[model samples]
Target: MPVRTAVPADLDALVALELRAFTGDRLSRAQYRRHLVSPHAAVLVADAADEGLLGSALVFFRKGSTLARLYSIATAPAARGRGIGADLLAAAEQAARRRGSRALRLEVRVDNAAAIGLYERAGYRRIGLYAGYYQDGADAWRYEKPLAVP
Candidate 1:
């Protein structure tokens, strides 16, 4: 699957993908619109012409910080187990590095074993946790991976 930086044309499809992959705390259409043009964000999508939109990732970077945060990542139900998530994650990391980020970070709900396992296998180490990080009072495990050797 080909993953590319998302453009305005992908807004609706991206929003739909987010809804399909997540239950709550999903990104809004407006948020997706803004992030598409935001200088601080890298919005990437897996676009397979025949399949339409497959997945998306919203990774953020601070102006003066070397740390890049993966705000969100989601793959459509039909695309799961096909490694689309890993492809999006790799693309996001490359984008962050191009933007001068040395490390990437993300927070996943503690109960999401699949996601947690994916992160671990990708070389991301759990470094901390946020109590009640989700709107539903679910805790989150924070993980980080260095894009460049420190």
Candidate 2:
């Protein structure tokens, strides 16, 4: 899978992947449109030559802050278990570094073992927890990873 910055043309595929991959707390089409053009955020997608979009990762950077937030990441069901999520994550980290962020933080549903494993394998450490963080009333575990300054 090749990862690159998302463009307006990717809107439909991105929205479809988000809808198929997540059941709640999903990003709206308008939000995705805004992020695709926002200077404070990076929307990245992993594309397959034949399959369109395989996954997407959204990261947000705040002015004067070294920490970047990995707001959301999702892989299409058909692309799961093939490392698409990891590829998007690595790309998100690089996107953050390019914007001068030194660390990346994210929140994952406590029940999402796959996502938790992906983050942990990528070197993110659990720092805290948020109760009732999801629309479905599930708790979220906060994780962070310090990016190496290049």
Candidate 3:
């Protein structure tokens, strides 16, 4: 369950996890490659020696902005309920903080109770809602957490 910044070598596993974890709004292989080197983005992955990649969290930051966006987070089907999501989340927050972000924001599918619970348990507050936010027209709940300065 070691979580680390994703590298180019992790591209394949990252894409695989993305495909296995979500049915829609999936990140393409090219996007994963781009994010791996993007100065404004951080792709963090949780991997094990035998399990390959357990999960990944993608975060985006903007110049001069104190807020970072948790663009996506996915845990492999076989790795769910193992706290991998939470671990990836904590790693994402840390990545954002390292970029000088004072707050982190994310949008989760309204029907995804497990994700909502994870965010809530991590101290993220429901800020608002976005209508028809997903590819399948599912609404999303906006959540935000203020990161304490370290």
Candidate 4:
């Protein structure tokens, strides 16, 4: 598996992966295409040796600050449990650090225990909660991890 910066051509596959990971509230092909062209966004793709675009991470830069916000991360259903998510996250963090970000932050659905676990394992700490953060009225757990040295 390889982790690399996403290109506009990868939008279709990313949309497919997003649909696979989240059965509800999926991003359309148009949204992904726009994401690829966004100036403040850094998207990474995880590609397999045989298959392509196994996973993706979309990181958006916070305005007027050195912080990178993880907007979304999803791995293909068939690619789950294979560390692809981990790889994509690592890439995102590294890219954020390279761009002078002091920390990485994101909100995970409170009901998504598995994703919370993954974020915890990746060194994020739950800093707060947001009520009704999701489209379906689900709450969110905000997590943050420092990217710079003490």
Candidate 5:
């Protein structure tokens, strides 16, 4: 398995993985494309030598000083349970820290226990909650991890 910075060439694979991982969610391909082209955004891909994209993580920088917000993270169905998600997350954190980010943050649906577990194990702490944050009216739990000691 190899972890690398996602390039425009990986757009198609990233989009496909987004659709699969977001099954019930509704973000269009155009939106995904726009994100890929955003100046403050980045996507990391985990590829298997013989296969292809195994996992992907999209991180966005909101207006402010050095803070990265992980928008969406997905691992190909066949690639789950193998630490691919963890690897992608570690890559994202490393990139953010290199970019001088002060912290990393993300919001996950309250019902997404699996992801919540992953985040917790990754050193993210639940900071707060947002009611009805998802289109489906699901509550979201905000998680954060400091990139540097304050």
Candidate 6:
């Protein structure tokens, strides 16, 4: 899989994929559009050979900070279990490192075992918990990992 910064052409597919990937608290189409051009955010898309988009990862690089947030990551249903998530994650970490981020952070639903496992396998460690973080009143586990400076 080839991971690259998302362009405006990827908007519709990204929006549609996220709608199916998350049951609630999904990013809006407008947000995706902004991310494509936002200086503080990096939106990456994973594409397969002749298959278009397989997943999208959004990371935020806070100004004047060494921390980058792995704001959102969504893989298409047909592309799950194919290592797309891991690839996207590694790509995010590398992108963050290039931008001077020393660490990457994210929040995941406490009940999402698979996602937690993926993050952990990628070296993210749980650092905190946010109560009722999601719109549907679900708690979130905060995780962070040190990024190797590029």
Best by the lDDT measure: 3
Predicted candidate 5 versus true structure: per-residue lDDT over 90-148, tens digit per residue? 88888788777889999999998889999999899999999999888899999999996
What RMSD value applies to candidate 4?
1.6
Task: Report the Cα RMSD per candidate.
Answer: 1.4, 0.6, 0.6, 1.6, 2.0, 0.9
Candidate 4 to truth, TM:
0.93
Measured on C-alpha atoms, candidate 1 has an lDDT of: 0.93
Per-residue accuracy of model 4 over 64-119 as CA lDDT, tens digit each: 88988998888888878999888888998998988789999999999988899899
CA-lDDT, candidates in order:
0.93, 0.94, 0.95, 0.88, 0.84, 0.93
Q: Candidate 6: global Cα-lDDT?
A: 0.93
What are the per-residue Cα lDDT tens digits for candidate 2 across 96-127?
A: 88888899999999999999999999999999
Per-residue lDDT of model 6, residues 1-150, tens digit only = 889998998899889889878888899999999999999999999987688788999999878999999999999888899999999999999999999999999999999999999999988999999999999999999999998895
Model 3: clashing residue pairs? none
What lDDT score goes with residue 70 in model 4? 92
> Residue by residue across 99-143, what tens digits does model 1's lDDT show?
889999999999999899889999999999999999999999999
Per-candidate count of clashing residue pairs (backbone under 3 Å): 0, 0, 0, 0, 0, 0
Give TM per candidate: 0.97, 0.98, 0.99, 0.93, 0.90, 0.97
Candidate 2 runs further than 4 Å off: none
lDDT of 3 by residue, 43-145 (tens): 9999898878999999999998999999999999988999999999999999998888999999999999999999999999999999999999999999999
At residue 15, what lDDT does model 3 achieve?
88
Which residue pairs clash within candidate 4? none
